[model samples]
Target: MAHTPELSPSQPSGSLHRMTAPALQPTETGTGTRQTQLLARMLLTPAVALLFIWMIVPLALTIYFSLLRYNLLDSESAQFVGFENFRYFLTDPAFLASLQNTLVLVGSVLGLTILLGIPLALLLDQPVIGRNIVRLMVIAPFFVMPTVSALIWKNLLMHPVSGLFAWIAKLFGAPPIDWFNDIPLFAIILIVSWQWLPFATLILLTALQSLDEEQKEAAEMDGAGALSTFIYITLPHLARPITVVILIETIFLLTVFAEIFVTTGGGPGLQTTNIAFLIYSQALIQYDVGGASAGGLVAVVIANIVAFFLVRIVGRNLEA
Candidate 1:
């Protein structure tokens, strides 16, 4: 300044002082951020890798096989057919029938499960003695293997001559019905529902338990009847869980095979045949790999469509 009073060597010029030493390296924060990113990637890698492998491998194989006229019985005869199998399946009467049966089976089970599950959940939510024991009993069916459940219903509960149904019919002086023959689809539906009802009940019951009791009390204070409070408050709270249950159950129901396989084998006349059973029959019994792969792809498409709508509906409800 005025001959800038001789600045000490220790005092730098203003420009030199203003110039920052390449910002002191934030070693700790930088290292921590890098380490955190690495740890997250390491943790997520396995699941991502597994899903990638699982999806890509089978899906690639299915697509490849769908284009070829492959037969399990005669590999040498394999040739590229490119959508012929899909065309055949689309036009096949048996395939169409199986699709119908699949829809019916899924619809029937879904309707019955929701109807029964909501009530069962409501009852289980009550402060009754041994409620936990009852809840366990209700969920027991879901724990049973599908094949075992089907067998139990077929042999012990629905068998015409010696089953419980027969015994009960006899007691009432009524004829024993051949459930598998007269209403084969209905029999399969019942078995599937019995197995899935427990799942629905468990989910809905958990949702019911988490409901806000203060809301119920407030409604009660407002002179709302029990029915009115449940309809307005409890039902709204349960809608999400119910949607989840239905979506998950539909996925399982669409691929239902073991119960139908063990119970009626998709017969008396393909009356209970579903897409899964149809795919099995095409691949194994007929040894038609191409057809089976096409059917499998179709099934996957239908399932995805249903899932898409269900997810969208549930997401909208959640946002609301």
Candidate 2:
């Protein structure tokens, strides 16, 4: 072969030139990283800011107030009191009663809604006359304003003498029962369940609709009974939706205030006083800012605890 021409001095050796020619600049790499970080922050900024304003700010204020002997009525006379307010809330009989009532209300409502919702969902999903109208009627309660719903139920359905319950009792040749006095907590539970039942039913019905029809047919062909097919296939398919319903409903139910406020006002000797109403009473009625703040913190802690387990459980089920 003919001898190669001598390379120019300005040009590097072949391998060195290939390796060093126009490598990416450090400045460009740094700029790219900064751009990525900026994009991420830009995307997350709104949500993070909203969460801080909604949850963090109020929480910080509550914690600060809980540590002081502040009263809304006497704000100028607030004194540092460490955990006195917390101690008082934990020790007070009214607070204890309210806590118990809260548990009962939450438990009863959740149980009833789940018990009724699954069947209703199944039934609603079936081909039936007036299915669309029935579904609309079922979900209508959830859209009603909480206070409005409470007032309607209180005045139109439970108004002792003139309400539906009283009318039904009279039709049965029985004395009209005073719902507020004889069954305040149960009454609240019923109202809450009625509002939430549609939510659960809608969720489960959607879940049911998403199930594979072939699987059910195969199960039936394999001699599996209706209950067995439902238990093994349908229920398992509904696990995620059920968990979602439970989590969302739990959060809303824990903060149940308007219903109790309008319907019972935490009456019948504090039997209907859930934590939300208790906090309101402390801050607005009692004018005890510190005590209310302590109560608020407690409610937050309890809610977070429930939420944590719920998320974890739902996450695991989803993974499986």
Candidate 3:
């Protein structure tokens, strides 16, 4: 064995202390905070810069095109026409009809989903056999492609002559109802609600599962009725999740294209054309790029307005 080196009084006694002393000593708090902040900013810079570019480029292009008298049919005649495109797009007779249809479609679907989702979520939350299978079945519709779902509804379910609904009606001595022909907007709403119902149910169920069991137990122990417990405890717990669902669903619903496309084709007349379909018609059908861009900007503004109100609701719920 090698002889151990003798410690010197003038130097540190132990290698461990020599190694760890500097590290273990308190760092300057201000210096550490500044270092942490700098590192965070450096890490965040790339993501922030990427997001900025992504949002800014499209917005800038849209603004630029919206101000021009650009048409795919007459590309050589393109000229800057400060808001003339916007004025024309807004003043179009189809604009009012499409706006009304959009409002109706969005409102009806939101109401139906929320009304149906809560009961479904509560039902699924209870103890039952094959609960997992039931949940998977319920959620399966949301995973189906929008176009496929629309076609399924159109041909298999809502078809006046040869559909399941028609068969059901015939069985009960009732005449088959032509869903799209009689109630086109409602038919669209029904299909959209079916597709979105699963999403709302999943979100609400998760919220239900996260509920504090002890509070529920306490409520029961205090002689609270089922309705009372739900009204007070369950409903309050669900407020935030409901707001989240509404916000997310509204954003997607604002741009619903596929279902309308595959089913009604935006009409028997212009009856089913929402703002999105109107914009599509302007750009692709009518070959008016400037008009479409202006319509797109209007859509953005409407979405932002709705989002602002929904955010306020969510914020209040969070605070409470």
Q: List the residue pairs that clash in candidate 3.
A: none
Q: Which prediction has the highest lDDT against the true structure?
A: 3
Model 2 steric clash total: 0
Candidate 2 has a TM-score of 0.85
Among all windows of ten consecutive residues in candidate 3, which has the lowest summed lDDT?
7-16
lDDT agreement with native, every candidate:
0.88, 0.87, 0.91
lDDT of 2 by residue, 117-231 (tens): 9999989878989998998999999898888888888889988999998999999999987888899898888888888999999999998988899999999999999999989
Name model 1 segments beyond 4 Å from true.
Answer: 1-25, 309-320
Backbone steric clashes in candidate 1, count: 0
The C-alpha TM-scores of every prediction are 0.88, 0.85, 0.85
Misplaced by over 4 Å in model 2 are 1-37, 313-320
- Report the number of clashing residue pairs per model: 0, 0, 0
- How do the residues 1-320 of candidate 3 rate in per-residue lDDT, one tens digit apiece? 23344432234233435455566644544455567668888999999999999989999998899999998988999999999998998998889999999999999999999999999999999998999999999999999999999999999999999999999999999999999989999999999999999999999999999999999999999999999999999999999899889888999999999999888888978889999999998899989999999999999999999889888887665544
Model 2, CA-based lDDT: 0.87
lDDT by residue (tens digit), candidate 1, 72-128: 978999999999999999999999999999889899999999999999999999998
Candidates, ranked, TM-score? 1, 2, 3
